[model samples]
Target: AQTVTQSQPEMSVQEAETVTLSCTYDTSESDYYLFWYKQPPSRQMILVIRQEAYKQQNATENRFSVNFQKAAKSFSLKISDSQLGDAAMYFCAYSKDSNYQLIWGAGTKLIIKP
Candidate 1:
């Protein structure tokens, strides 16, 4: 069975600072895609970052970066110089090319403190 765990249910960081949201996943597939999505008040899931299991380089998008540890099955999201817009429900998910369904974690609510 595949699963993702986010130990922190909620996180708070001051504006313009950095915050890392921890996520650990369990999967048997050697090749898969790890994802981090943010759902704001609008409830739209925005892709923050994505990483391939086989790729050694971490994926980064603007202020968002991922610390992907394939051996440890850990894929954590890092937000640098966070802004108020960054506050949202952050979800960690993983999916294989063969499987269209995404296995998601209990989202962590990020609160940006001004």
Candidate 2:
């Protein structure tokens, strides 16, 4: 079984600043997948970035990037140049493979301190 945990319940950052949200996971498999999803007030799940367990380089997508530590089982999301629109609940997810279900973290509510 795999589980993800987000230690930060809520985080705030000024517009244009950067913020890093912490996440850790427990998995037995050597190869798996990690993902960061953003859910705004609309409640729609949006994939911010994804990292393959075998990949050594961190995954990045524009303002979103992940610091994936395979040995530590930690995958943290870094949001750069944060915007007001970025305010939402971010979730850390893990999956063994395509056929498996995604294990989700509790969630981190992001607030923009405009």
Candidate 3:
């Protein structure tokens, strides 16, 4: 069985700073994909970033990036220049061999302090 664990239930960051959210997973499969999804007040799950287990380079999208440590099974999200709009519930998910069925984390609520 695969499971994603998010140790932090909630996090806060001041506007214009950076925040990193932690995630860890357990899986027997050697190949898999990791993702971070953001759900705002509207309840829409938005894909923040993704990382392939085989890729040595961490995935990045603009101010959003992931520190993917495959050996340690750690995938953390770093949000740069945090803004009010960045406040949301972030979930860490895992998919094996492109199954598309995601094993999800409990989710972390990010609050932006002005």
Candidate 4:
């Protein structure tokens, strides 16, 4: 069974700064996919970023990025220039393959300090 874990239950960041949320997973498959999803107060799941296990370079999207360590089975999300809009619950997920079902972490509640 593949399992994703987010050690931090909650996190806070000042507007215009940066923050990184930690995540780890245990999986038997060597090749898989990782994803970070953000759910705002609206409760809509949005894909923040994704990483393919075979890729050596971490994925980046504007101010968001990931640190993927395949050997350690760790994948973390980094949000730069954080904004109030970024305050939300972030979940780390894993999938055996692109089309397979996802394994989700509990989530980390992110609060933006005004």
Worst window of 10 by summed lDDT in candidate 4: 65-74
**Worst-scoring 10-residue span by lDDT in model 3:** 94-103
TM-score (all chains, Cα) for each model: 0.96, 0.97, 0.97, 0.97
lDDT string for model 4 (20-87, tens) is 99999999998999999999999999999999999999999999999999898999999999999999
Please write out the lDDT profile of model 3 over residues 14-62, one tens digit for every residue: 9999999999999988899999999999998999998889889999999
Please identify which of the two predictions, 1 or 2, would achieve the higher lDDT against the true structure: 2
Q: What would the TM-score be for candidate 2 when compared with the true structure?
A: 0.97
lDDT of 2 by residue, 7-73 (tens): 9999999999999999999989999999999999999989999999999999999999999999999
Worst 10-residue stretch by lDDT in candidate 1?
94-103
lDDT on C-alpha atoms for all candidate structures? 0.93, 0.95, 0.96, 0.96
Q: After superposition, how far is residue 58 of candidate 2 from its true place, in Å?
A: 0.6
Residue 52 Cα positional deviation in candidate 3, in Å, after optimal superposition: 0.8
Candidate 3, superposed: residue stretches over 4 Å from native = none
RMSD of each: 1.0, 0.7, 0.7, 0.7
